[model samples]
Target: MPPYVPRPIVVDYEEACRIRDLSPKASATLSRRCLQGMIRDFHGVREGTLAKEIEKIKDKIDPVTWDSIEAVRKIGNIGAHMEKDINVIVDVEPEEAGLLIGLIESLIEDWYIARQQRAERHAAIQALAAQKEAARKAGPTQGAGAAQPNP
Candidate 1:
């Protein structure tokens, strides 16, 4: 997890990792919650349901990424919501859970890490521009070997 990521999201992601093999369902649930928190914090889209919130960002994000988010939501749904028949037990494979975790990791990189890097780059450019402007305003300086004007 990136150091810039919020503690809540990191906690959920870590918990998901801790139990991914032991309980894929629980892990998926945690991943789902983590995704929701990210959407809320990063995108500022807090709808009634995760699905609705995701829909709001469909045009904002790339199609492939949107599809991945939908996939996570659907797969996580299995663990989050109960089926009509209480007796039935639908299992989520460990591989599927791992996929969810991988998606979360990718999102953290794509969203938070990428944004921070971009901001830093922009700031650096601004600082460089400021330095150049200052130097330009100060005018050219004469070299030590250059002839000095007669007093």
Candidate 2:
């Protein structure tokens, strides 16, 4: 939301959007929910230190995904508390609100897709490594060992 002028450096992306009547869309909501779902699926953060937990495993996430997720999170905070404009919240515009929603949706989608791709890659690597380890352990088979299959 851009129409509402901010108080100095203070920023409230959510509230700004609301004041300007640019509330988030259903797709944005769905995307945000999906991202939340991932958080839930990975770690049942039912209570404290959710950010720390996510940070602890941050390296496991793709950098782009992580960035997008963080951006959406920041914007979400602004949107959710935009109306709470006090010493705590910031102001925004309807246009800014729409942008935030779009950004949120895109980021969430990227996080989901990137995470899946990475998981698959990791699984494949593990499988290949396991196969190699097994082959090494098996060595040359019995008489085949005596024959010296390779120089």
Candidate 3:
């Protein structure tokens, strides 16, 4: 629903700054403190829902995708609690955050893609099932056991 986890990085960044002895510098595109606030809500990710739904359609997806989503979810937690150098909590240089950003992005992408594919597969299953039922009822029209050529 939201992003991944509900908390934003900005809040933690600010807390980090307080713990560390650094002030927001001029060149940093995002000070962890303020940047976290900008992150979208990520708490509503329904792991239970996803897990249950995925179980029904796992065969239609790339396993790697599922793994990526899981990794992103775990990393999100780590990033939330990440410590910067000097406890700023540690420095998350732009380049470093960039890598993490990539992971997060990939994770989100995989999650959505998997979900869509799963939905499609589910619909297909229902359609096939319905067709089979219809066929079953229309059977034996001209089989060997049919009425004796209507005499």
Candidate 4:
């Protein structure tokens, strides 16, 4: 089955990867946007900047995952807000930009796709159990001499 990435998130991530080699800066910017959107959509965090939102949910996610998220935020910020006067031109290498895209893909799979698959499995199990139960209930009455034979 296809992965469960949201349409908007998919669009950004795809665009980011598409231009990763030619335009690392733009890729990083899109990656940052994708990360922000994922946090909002998956974790239901809708406040402050990406960094602040991540900080709010630091305890909810694994420490390693949290750190990765912060890294992307910092790098993306540099790419997004280049300042000429400050002379802050952070270079986003193609490999680094690829990592950002990778992180987004992982988040989509881990958070959205896995949850959805689990829910579907749970529902299927429940349905099968219900069917078996109904069949068991009917079996006792329909067999042998439990009821009068039809003429």
TM-scores of all candidate predictions against the true structure? 0.91, 0.39, 0.37, 0.87
Candidate 1: where is the Cα deviation over 4 Å?
142-151
Compared with the true structure, all predictions reach lDDT values of 0.94, 0.50, 0.43, 0.87
- Candidate 4 structure quality by residue, lDDT tens digits, 1-151: 1556778888998899899999998898999999999889888998878878999889999999999999999889877885767865668899999999899889888888889899999999999999989978877575565776679
Q: Which regions of candidate 3 fall more than 4 Å away from where they truly are?
A: 1-91, 140-151
Candidate 1, residues 1-151, lDDT tens digits: the string is: 6688999999999999999999999999999999999999999998989999999999999999999999999889999999899998889988989999999999999999999999999999999999989977987667775457779
Q: Give candidates' CA RMSD values in order.
A: 2.5, 11.8, 11.6, 3.6
Instruction: Kindly list the per-residue Cα lDDT of model 2 for residues 1-151, writing each as its tens digit.
Output: 2222222211332433344464443323333444454455444443343345456546876887677666545555554434553666455444555665555445434544555777789999999999989988977665654555555
- Give Cα distance to truth, residue 113, candidate 2, Å: 6.1
Best-fitting candidate, scored by lDDT = 1
Which one wins by lDDT: 3 or 4?
A: 4
Model 4 steric clash pairs? none
lDDT of 2: 0.50
Reference-based lDDT, residue 118, model 1: 98
Cα displacement (angstroms), candidate 1, residue 143, comes to 5.4
Candidate 3 lDDT (Cα, whole model)? 0.43
- Worst lDDT 10-window in candidate 1: 139-148
